[model samples]
Target: MSAAATTSQPRRPRSGNRRDEAARLAVLHAADDLLVEHGFGALTVEAIARRAGVAKQTIYRWWPSKVEILLDTLIEDSAKRIPVPADEPTAESVRGYLRGFARFLTRDPAGKVLLALLAEAQHDPDTARSLHERCLAPRRARERAMLTGATDAGEIAPTLGPDATMDALLGPIVYRALTGASIPRGLVDTLVDALLRPRAN
Candidate 1:
């Protein structure tokens, strides 16, 4: 097209996806700074905006509330992705992968953010659904594959339920996190061992 013709054409609007993503990142960074300085109880949206140097309306334009911004911040700051395994999926490999993931959550900055987000998720259904879609479901499916694969390999009882096994494996880590107990690494190892180790029937 001629430069004249190009100039005459109506300009397309900025990409909403890119703009929204930039806005989201800004809010998340703001939230992270506030959280580190003041902790969860005092990390308000107004505080986040002040730190981000954006107006509160700008933050709200991308996120509905302070909790939503915090959830996204946790996810972005996490070193690992939803399907968190670090290697190919043998049952043993999968067990090892998840243990490493759990340990990271306990020891890393992102882990603290995830714990904070989980506490918020208890009272917020929107955050709960987003967490399920963004984090929980993908990891659940990966673990499910490892559990169900054992049956196909004739290692586990085909009669056994994959869903039940997944619940058995995941339930304890979450339980310990919620219950305010010091979880032994041994407990997680035990759960993995019971689920993935070959059982003689």
Candidate 2:
């Protein structure tokens, strides 16, 4: 056989993966819509599949449960809106990040869904663990690093513990959300100020 005749043909392009990703995003969008419209109690794998116009098996093949689907949707939505700030001065980073975080908690859809998750966690240990591990833990780790940076820069008190500072900065925001109280417009600034100001000896 001639050498040219023996050459292999170019491989065909694959658009199947793009279709799959689109379907996956559709499922997530459906889940997010359901959470906002019907709350977590109304979200189910079957319902999401129906809403997304995909087979139930499709959702099951990717996510194990309704909560897992919801968690993924929540995380994806959050990443788009509340990205971690770039490295900068500690005071600026802390204040800006917290302000954005607090604003997210007070708005529609995201705030409502998060509050629903918190409520769900209270009764379901598995859900609680998943939320903490998948959602909360990563953000907490970042916050810890930010606090350590702030301390290293002398933007806050040297004596302040990073863990304690995290609690101080976040506790109020969570508390207000859980309690149905308004997150004051100035609460972010207030918290930042309180965080940066050293306690009098």
Candidate 3:
């Protein structure tokens, strides 16, 4: 067969198949709603399938476990909620970006899902690794880039570094989420100020 013919050979049935794709999205939406309504410990593959109106085997065919399903949802929602900031001065961009991130945590389903996943990870090392790889890593990389830009522009002190700066900004947000505390008014501004505070000469 010609190379074009060989390359264009019928694609095998896979996750992208229309019916399966619909089922997959249904499963993800079901997982998101269930995670929010019932918390992580109570979530089950059977419950998700029942809610999605798909056979349990359908979920198993696409995702190995509930964690993977939730992770996919988190990734999708975060990407939609937290966009990369436009070209701008480092400080302004970082401030806008972090503010958006804070909003995502407080205002989106992804935030609740992430908190549940983090809690689950504390008891399961495998879950921790998967969460790190599937969700945290990409998000952190974006954070790092923002910090790196700020540092390059002399907006961040050399001593604090990106990792430390990220922790400082996220620590309170995570704490509030864990404790169910509201994100206080102007908290994002406060976080940005703390992160970008001037260092003594």
Better of 2 and 3 by TM-score: 3
lDDT of 1 at 156: 47
Error of 3 at 8 (Å): 21
Ranking by lDDT: 3, 2, 1
Please, what are the lDDT tens digits per residue for candidate 2 over residues 1-201?
453332221111123467777888888788888888887887788889999999987677677788887787778777777766547447777787887778787775666667788899999999999999998888778778777777778776634587777788878997898787888868877877777775787
- Please provide TM-scores, in order, for all candidate models, with all chains considered together: 0.71, 0.84, 0.86
Which is superior by TM-score, 1 or 2? 2
Model 1 residue pairs with clashes: none
**What TM-score quantifies how close candidate 3 is to the native fold?**
0.86
Assess each prediction's global lDDT (C-alpha) against the native: 0.65, 0.76, 0.78
Candidate 1 residue lDDT tens string, 14-40: 344576556556667778777756777
Model 3 lDDT per residue over 1-201, tens place? 564553343222243459866877888899999988998989999999999999987677667789988998988888888865534447767777777777777778878898888888999998899999978887887777777766777766545777788888888878787788887758878877766866486
lDDT (Cα) of model 3: 0.78
Best by TM-score: 3
**Candidate 3 — which pairs collide?**
none
Query: Which of 1 and 3 is the better model by lDDT?
Result: 3
Off by over 4 Å in 3: 1-15, 84-89, 154-158, 199-201
